[model samples]
Target: MTVTHVHSIDTAPDPVRWPDIARVPSGVTARFGAPIAARLFRRAASRLDVRVALPDGTNLGSGDPRAPLMRVHRPAAFARRVAADGLIGFGEAYMAGDWDAPDPAAVLTPFAASAATLVPRALQVLRPLVLPGQPAAERNSAANTRSNISRHYDLSNELFALFLDDTMTYSSALFGEVPARWDALEAAQHRKIDRLLDEAGVGAGTRLLEIGTGWGELAVRAAQRGAHVRSVTLSSEQQELARRRVAAAGFADRVRIDLLDYRGVRGEYDAVVSVEMIEAVGFEYWPTYFETIDRVLVPGGRVALQAITMPDARMRATRGTYTWIHKYIFPGGLLPSTEALEQAAAHTALRTEGRLGFGSDYADTLRLWRERFTANADAVAGLGFDATFRRMWEFYLAYSEAGFRSGYLDVQQITLTKGGAS
Candidate 1:
């Protein structure tokens, strides 16, 4: 794909100055914090397996010849960014071309692996002075949820199509092997969806409620299983494409796509299925999310949920903090731990029946996505997204891939049953 015209980068300016997205600490705070952050980063890097190369011909970390190499282009800027916003600034620095790596994911994995202990316990207490809380405007309230969803999902349907597999599934795919091939991605996605459908017991004449309609692939699959489906999403772009895809697949009669919030969904169903949707619901609303599902799910019905989960300690620690992801990728999102999900369900009639985690598969999936995205950079640029936007997207994908690669993040297909079914 080629571009006839490029949109102004000014339209999507760098988010470094976005106070709601990332807070630049006061001069006094930065004066003290920058040196502290630089020292801590150097100390942390010295122990990691990777190598960090500075412009002054100095290298940190173990200097393992086989380890990934992180090259810092503008050290002072990088230090100040990290001091100002922590991880969020780290990402912004990447977007601003302050640092780079031959393989960004490879360089990020070790850091993600040591996420819990990167800063000393004493220094971690200073996090509140640097990091900002989740912006109230980005919260998952009934009204704000739509805007939050629009920010990412509604960017452009065509933009997503450029990178995703033919199945158009955005969530993780369940690959059959460790190193999955690109040609098998569509099949892997189908397999993942099939597992969810099977766990939900969706079959002939069954009524299904899907909380997130991602380009309608899942809905079509459910309809193919002889289930009547109602799918809801906050993205108009996704809804439009999903509706067209459903009609094209001849499942339009069996599926109904609605531009509605999950909280506003008003029907009882045999099965309730949501894939990676719970993350968009803020931590404070998790109970409400499960309660809504409980209210709509009939007794004896199954709820198959695909969720991206982090460790409980990590979730609790970061739930209220704004990060790079919140700034440039997904806003108002928080990954729940397995324990947290179960606790949320405890407040409702839903009980966990089973759970299967495929974090490695997600890592593989994201690697493929990142590769494809880079390969299609021109196409992405042709879609009018500027260079900074491209860098942000690349960093977001690499950052996420590294999380899964290091086991800092995980994806789980969890089965829940109404009325405490065993």
Candidate 2:
């Protein structure tokens, strides 16, 4: 039976939902702890332009009307979240209906802009005292990688299709200098993929290695150019769909989509490409990741990496903080700084050829995704995902977009060459 179908509109799986209701509470800590944490939040935002409104109609901040407003419906719950989970509680509070921000991105923008200065110098030194430890199980060890990847990637494909464009490119789409319409999303995604391919110098007879096979667009596109591509991924759901897409596009012979982790991948190739996959490599494993690429690539082989990056100082500050994103969205992920990449490259068999940051493009991409997701909220809930899940995703997308909007984060496509340039 030949399966050449492209896009099948399949119903989502009714997977077991979140809110581990079985877990036991730690102690009476949250009872008294939440209020103290709420006061700290008030103190932190006191100088920021944004206002955090209380139940009594009083607010915290500089009282700037131009700034975004956050309504705390249940300060106790919001504070309890922060007190117990630290950063994770912030987003959880929203899911629990403790807070409301009509424009999350807008409200978050000011906070994101002031992220570097949120804690004063005197207080920053006490961060170890204030912050919670990263979950030991969330660490991206060889044994634990697949579980971490599955928790997010293995979530129903139909859920993603509900919001993503026809191309199904989940990462940032480079919509170019001028703001493009929603219709240009698929094309923008192609542009982004094509740019990475072009930078990697993929063409006929070029043996390409893609570290993270998201779906099959990149593999199919590369194969269309007569390149033989071998893409690797750990996501079972992603691999199944990617392989199906590859077969559908008649690229089964040219493109091999393997369910293999980067740690175990074998073979040397002419070009290596990984789109926004480096974030999952973990800070401790960065060197080994680069080394793996170095070992797999032939001499003069080109490498193009599309990565989400944060400022060095911010990365330093939040690297160890178990945030909401780690808990609910992308587990075991950490955005690296440009300097971190350069520092790692300086010691590896790779040298940077070129780098392009498209943080604004990501902001636009996320905005469109959020809008689309919001528009299809009913359909999403119909897919067996609860309201809490929808709001969690909404916050994830908006929070990410805000990070880019505030220039606190960026997405860069860096081109590198083995043993320097050819």
Global fold similarity of model 1 (TM-score): 0.93
What local distance difference test score does each model get? 0.86, 0.82
lDDT of 2 by residue, 1-422 (tens): 01111111132212345442112124465667777777778887787778888898888886778677778887777787777666567777766657767677777777788877765577568667766767889888998889989999899888889889988899999988656568999999999999999999999999999999998899999999999999999999999999988998898999998888898988879999999999998988888889899989999999999999999987887798877888788888899999988887777889999999989999888888888888888798798876667777888888898899888999999999998444
Candidate 1 lDDT tens digits, 1-422: 01012122234344664432233445665667788778988998988898999999999897579888888877877887888778887987777667888788888899999999998888678677667998999999998999999999999999999999988999999996634878989999999999999999999999999999999999999999899999999999999999999999999899999999999989789999999999999888999999999998888999999999999998888788898898788899988998898888897888888989999999888888888888888899899877778878878888898999999999999998888444
**What are the per-model C-alpha RMSD values against the true structure?**
4.0, 6.2
Q: Find the number of clashing residue pairs for candidate 2.
A: 0
Stretches off by above 4 angstroms in model 2 are 1-29, 62-66, 420-422
The whole-model C-alpha lDDT of candidate 1 against the native structure comes to: 0.86
Model 1: CA > 4 A from native: 1-26, 420-422
Colliding residue pairs in candidate 2? none
Residue 375 displacement in candidate 2 (angstroms): 0.8
